[model samples]
Target: MQVTSHFYAQLTIAIIKGVASCLRLFHVLGLIILCSSLSLPLHAIEQSSNTQIKQVHLHDNQGKSINIGQLHVQADGQFTFELRDEVFSDHFLSMKEMKYIEGPELWCHIAYPYPLNRDFNADKAWLSHDLLFMYKKSNQFGAMMWQGVYYKFTKEDGRLIGYANGVDLSEIASAPEQIHTPFYDESYMEPHNAQERWLPTLTID
Candidate 1:
C-alpha cells in the first residue's frame, strides 16, 4: 500500500511539472507576440525596397562623362537623388547636374497656375551642368528638365511638386554585382527612328 501511494505521488508531481512547463512556454510565446506587435515599424513594409540604387550619368564639362545624382526612391514615395556636384554648373547633371524625374502623381506641385503670371510662375533655373535647362512650362506649367538633366520647380498652388522617380534596378539585386550590363543606351533611342519623331535619350558610355 505504501509503495502504491509513493508511485501515485510521484506521478502527480510529474503531471504538475509538465503543466507548469506548458504554462511557462505559453507565457513566453504571448510576450513575444506582444513585443512584436508594439515594435513594428510604420514604414517597415514601405521601406523594404528603399535601399535600391540605380545607375545615373550625365555629360559633364570638358565634354567628359560624369555621374551626378545617385537616384533612389523612398518609403514615403519620393525621390532622393544624391548629386556629386555641390554647385549648379554648366554641364554634368548625372555627375552633380540636375536630374529628370517621372513618377506617379509627381508633376503637380512643380506646375504653375495655367494663367502663369510671374507671381504664379516659379523661378526658372538653368543647370549649367550637363547643359540641362529647367523651365516651368507656362502652358502646362510643370517643370521640364531639358538638355538631359532632371530638375524641378515649385509653384505652391500646384498639386504635384516634381516628377516621381522610378525604381532602382540595383534594388532588385541580392548580392554585390560583379558583371555589370553595359550602359549602352542606343536601343533606348532606336525605336524613335521615324523621321522628325523625337528619339529616346541614348548614352554613349
Candidate 2:
C-alpha cells in the first residue's frame, strides 16, 4: 500500500510538470508570432519612405529625343529633373538628323507643377509626350505638362514659342479651374524665335 501511494504521487507530479512545460512553450510561440505581425507594416513603411531614381527622355513634338535627363523622385511622389545644357538651338531644331553638339553646360532645374498626392498614380505615358514646359529662369518655377490643361503664359522676363501644341481649357469640361493661374495666359502662343526657344527633346542613353 505504501509503495502504491508513492507511485501515484510521482505520476501526478510528472503530469503537472508536463502540462506546465507545454503552456510555457505555447506562450513563447505566441510572443514570436505577435512580434512578426507587428514588423510587417514597419518594413513596408521603410520601403515606401525610400526615394527612387529614374532615367527619362524629354521628347520633342516630332518624336525625337534631344537630351537625357535624370528624374529624382521622392517617396511622397514629388519629382524633379536636372538639365545640364541649353536644349534649343537653330542648328538642332531645323535639322531632323544631327548629333546635338553645341550648348553651354549649365544646370536647369525642372520643378514639379503642383503638389502631387502621395498616392498619385505614376503614368509612364505622361512622362513620354510632346509636351510643353513653362518655366521662369530666375525664379526656377519650371513646370511641364501635356496638351490637356490650357496654360496662360505670362510674359515675365520670358518668352513662349508656339512650336509645341497648346490646350484650350475652355474646351474640356473636366479641366481644373486652377489653369487660370497667373503663370499662364489666354494669349495665343507666338511662333518660336531666335531669342525665345522651346524645350528640346531629351534622350536616355
Candidate 3:
C-alpha cells in the first residue's frame, strides 16, 4: 500500500510539472503574439515594391546631364526618390532653405494627393521630401523639394513612360497657413510655372 501511494504521488507530481510547463509555453507564445501585433503598424506603411532601385537622371535647360539619384516608381505612378547631398551644393539649386534639411541623403516622394497619374490630370504634380514634417513643426511654410511641378507620361505599346519637367523651387517659400494645411490639401494645387527652368527634363530608367 505504501509503494502504491508513492507511485501515485510521483505520477501526480509529473502531471503537475507537465501542466506548469505547458502554462509557461502558452505565456511565452502569448508574449510573442503581442509583440508581433505591436510591430505590424510600422511595417504596414506603403512600399513601392518588395525592393527595387531604379536610376534617375536630370537634364537641365542647358542640356547638361545630371545624376539625380535612385528612384522607385510604383505601378500606381507614385515615385520614391533619394537624392545625393552633393546635388544640393551644386549651383543648379539656389535655395537657402535646403540647409535646414537635417540628413546626408534626401528622400522625396510624389505620392498620395500628388501621385503621378496618366489617366487623370498628368500634367501637374508635386514632389515632397521626407523632411516636410520637420518644417511643419516650426509652423513655417516650406517644402524640401518642388511643389508645383510638371510631369508628362507616355505609353509605348502599353508600357508607361514618365517624364518630369521644369520645377519651381520658390514654391518652397509659401504662405505660413500652408504649413498647417494637410499634404492632401488641394487648395494650393496648381499648374507649374512656364518660366521655371531648373530641371527641364528628367529621364527615369
Candidate 4:
C-alpha cells in the first residue's frame, strides 16, 4: 500500500515519540484545553499548599544574562511561564507559531525553530491536567519540539521537559534583520556571543 506523505510523517513522528517515551517522556492522553488569552493558567491548583515557585537568571552562552522570569510548579502537576517585563517583549519571535504547553508569563517565547533562544521563561501549566511541560514551535529553521514531562516525577526523575506535536515545519525561514536582535526593547540591550544562532532552545528546571 502506497502511503501519503502526511501519514508517513505522522508515523515517523509517532515512532520518535515512542522512543522518547521509553526514554522516560510522559504523554498525557486527552484533549488539549487552551487558555482563552495569552496568559499563564494558574487558577487550576490554587488550593495546593505545596506549590512552590522560584526566581532565577536566564542566560546566554557567553554567560551574559538576557531575560528575567519565575518558574511555578504545583503538587497537582501544573506548569506556568511568565516574563518579568515587556522590555523583552519588543523582540518577541513568532509567538503564534510558537505556542507552548502553557501561556507565556514572559513577553515572548524563543525555541529551536525560532529566533532568539532568549525569548521567554517557564511556568506550571493548566494543560495536560496541568502537567508540568514546556514547548517551542516555528516554521523557520524548520519545526522542532522537545518535551520532558515525567508523570512518575520523583525527586530523581524531575518533573518536566519540553514537547512538540510531531509535525513538520512550514513557511519558516531565518527571521529578517528587524526581528533578529537579541531580545530587547529600547530600554535594554544585551548582546550574545559572536556566533550566529538560528537554533535557539532553552529550558529552566
Candidate 5:
C-alpha cells in the first residue's frame, strides 16, 4: 500500500506539471496573435501617409489654364513639376547659375541679352508643398539668369495666386527697381526674342 501511494503521488505531480506547460504555451501563442494584429494597422497608416498626388488641375488667377505635364511627389515631401508647353522649354537658367543669383545685389550685373541654351531640368529644383502654399527656388530673370529668386504661391479656392517672391525687397538697396515677376503671360515670338515676352501664371483647379 505504501509503494502504491508513492506512485500515485508522483503521477499526480507529473499530470499537474503537464497541464501548466500547456497553459503557458497557449498564453504565449495568444500574445503573438495579439501583437501581430496590432502591427497591421500601423503598417497600413504608414502606407497611406506616403500616398502621392498624381495629377492636379492647375489654372492661373486670370482664369487661364496651364499645362503641367507631370507631377511626381516623393515620400519626403519633395516634388517635380514638368511643364507641358513647348514655349517655356529651354527658357530657364542652369542650376549652377541659380546658386550665384540667390545672393544680394549680385544678380543685377548679369545681362539678359545672352540666353542660356540649357533645357529646363525639373530634377534640379527642390519643391516644397505646405498646407496651401508651394515654395520653390527660382531665377530672377524671367528669360535670363542674373539673380536667385524664390517664389511662393497660395493654393486656395481652386486657384493658385502668386503670393510673394524672395525677401521683402522694400528694405534692400540692390533689389530690382521694378519687381519683374517670373512666369508672366508671354507668347513665344521668336527663338532669339523669347526673353521679350511673358507667360501666363499657373493655378490649380
Candidate 6:
C-alpha cells in the first residue's frame, strides 16, 4: 500500500508538471503573436509617412502663376493637382498625348474620359469631350466642352464661358458640384486676349 501511494503521488506531480509546461509554451506563443500584430501597424504608418508629394509651379495664359502644393498620379494614369491655398483639392487631370505645338507659351492640356456626373449612367448617357487648358505665362485656365460651353479662370476671378445653358463653375461651392456640364451657364462669358506665346515643350528623355 505504501509503495502504491508513493507511485500515485509521483504520477500526480508528473501530470501537473506537464500541464505547467504546456501553459508556459502557450503563453510564449501568445506574446510572440501579440508583438507581431503590433509591429504591422507601425510599419504601415512608417510607410505612409514616407510617401512623397511632388510640387509644381504653373502659370496661366494671363501671366498669373500658381504654386501647386502636391501632385499625385493615380494607378489609372490620372493626375491630381492640389493647389497651395486649398482652392482645389484632388483636381483630376488626364494627359494621354503630348502634341507638339510650336509656340512660345507653356500650356498644359488635359482630356477627361470619366463622366463628371456620378449618377448619370455612362452606357446610355451622351458623352461630351471634356478638355481643359492651363497656360504657363498668362495664368489662365479654361475648359472647353463639345456641347459648346466652357469655363475660364484667371488669378482674380473665374467665369463660365460659352452658351448660357450650362452649369456655372463659379457657383460650385464643392468639388462634387463641379462635375456636371449641364449645370454651367453660357451667359457669363467675358472677353479676354488670348496669349500667342507658350512655354517650352516638355522633353522626356
Ranked candidates (lDDT, high to low): 3, 2, 6, 5, 4, 1
For each candidate, the alpha-carbon lDDT, in order, equals: 0.34, 0.41, 0.45, 0.35, 0.38, 0.39
Which candidate tops lDDT? 3
Query: Per-residue lDDT for 93-172 in model 3, tens only?
Result: 23433322222223232223322233121332233322121111223344434443444435455333334433443444
Error of 4 at 109 (Å): 2.1
lDDT (10s digit) by residue, model 4, range 133-153: 222333334223222221111
Give candidate 4's TM-score: 0.29
Tell me the deviation in Å of residue 187 in model 4.
39
> After superposing candidate 6, which stretches have Cα over 4 Å from the reference?
53-205
- Scored against the true structure, residue 138 in model 6 reaches a CA lDDT of 27
Q: What's the TM-score of each model vs. the native?
A: 0.28, 0.34, 0.38, 0.29, 0.30, 0.34
Cα RMSD, model 1: 18.4
Q: For model 2, how does the per-residue alpha-carbon lDDT over 65-123 read when each residue is reduced to its tens digit? A: 44444555677776555554455332221232222323222122223343333221353
Give the clash count for model 5: 14
Report the number of the highest-TM-score candidate. Answer: 3
Q: Between the candidate structures 1 and 3, which one is better when assessed by TM-score?
A: 3
- For candidate 1, the 10 contiguous residues with the lowest summed lDDT are 104-113
Ten-residue segment with the worst summed lDDT in candidate 4?
147-156
Residue 11 Cα positional deviation in candidate 4, in Å, after optimal superposition:
93
Model 5 is weakest, by summed lDDT over 10 consecutive residues, at 123-132
lDDT of 2 at 107: 20
